[model samples]
Target: VQISKKKFVADELTEDGYSGAEVRVTPTRMEIIMLATRTRAALGEKGRRIPEWTPVAQKRFGFPEGSLCAIALRYKLLRGLAVQRPCYGVLQFIMESGAKGCQVVRAKSMKFVDGLMIHVGDLVNYYVDTAVPHVLLPQGVLGIKVKTMLPWDPTGRTGPKKPLPDHLSIVKPKDEILPTTPILGQKGGKPEPPTMPHPVPTA
Candidate 1:
């Protein structure tokens, strides 16, 4: 089978009681041209030179300094999405351990969308360190109960809600332990130490 810009052509092989036939599949003209153009552009010289840009030139090509250029290429080629604009705060956070980033930033915001399954009043759990019994709520910890699910906008006073800065405040659910019946000597009483048998009287 040969796939061309305009059509897919295949020569049928004779088997059983069937006659050999030629098969052809032609796509729409626009789609064919679009596919062909993309193919040539990708497989031609332009594709090879894309990776040769210097660090500075690469920045201009939509990659941040010290960031993964390969990720940008993959995003463009596979997802058909533009490279993410550099978040200097996030970049600094990556380079310097103590550096701080934006107040509200998600590691991978693109993967999640609005209208997730979590609903209001659902139970959620979060863990705390053994030493520290109190819970420590991070900026974006998962498994947090949804307090209030506001609409795109809370009130009509504000304009349309922006995509970023998700306005949900989450809380950890209270710990609930099932009550158990205590053993006769297990609680509020001491277990009797093993006692030696009194010496038996001589027969």
Candidate 2:
């Protein structure tokens, strides 16, 4: 099972409890790296549920049988949040989960705090983790955008050497609960500088 060539995909696929995936190849075999909100849900308990997607991927990508290995890593804030307090919960979760900083944005009528959640910007291509889940408000439907700076190393080798700005890092948030820290935005004031994580390998 020596591989002569390889292919890698980043953030191309996302599903419930699943955020993204990557493909890696070694001389011995191929590795399918799955990123999800819950490893158990994505890989199943003890991976007894791998058959659910393995065949699909193998056929879609044309990988040889028995040569592909599927594994999962966990991330958060992968899903959208509801309105009001749930938004606050997101902020708290990201910070508590080791994010350097975080922010939430919504319509002018639904202010989480006075100035914290007001500022806005074009985050369509921002590097950090973002979610634009829609909510049904009394007035109409509105979209809530969440952005956070996480301590993730995209390269997965020796972590990042320098500090990543709030816009460039990944983030995680737990169950919907009010977050204590003020939410920052694209045009918001600079947040406190984040401490660098120890240099180590990441998925």
Q: What is the lDDT of residue 157 in candidate 1?
A: 31
Residues 1-203, candidate 1: write the lDDT tens digits: 22431132111111212222233333310111112223434333544423443243434333232233222232233323232332232233332532111121223353212222222232211110001011123333222111112223334232223322445766899999876965657656887888999998998
Q: Candidate 2: misplaced stretches above 4 Å? A: 1-83, 108-127, 152-203
Residue 182 miss distance in model 1 (angstroms): 86
Report the Cα lDDT for residue 69, model 1.
Answer: 29
lDDT of 2 by residue, 90-120 (tens): 4564556555555666654553422122134
As a TM-score, model 2 comes out at 0.30
Query: How high is each candidate's TM-score?
Result: 0.16, 0.30
What lDDT would candidate 1 get against the real structure? 0.28
As for model 2, its CA RMSD to the true structure in angstroms is 25.7
After the best TM-score superposition of candidate 2, give how far the Cα of residue 96 lies from its true spot, in angstroms.
Answer: 1.8
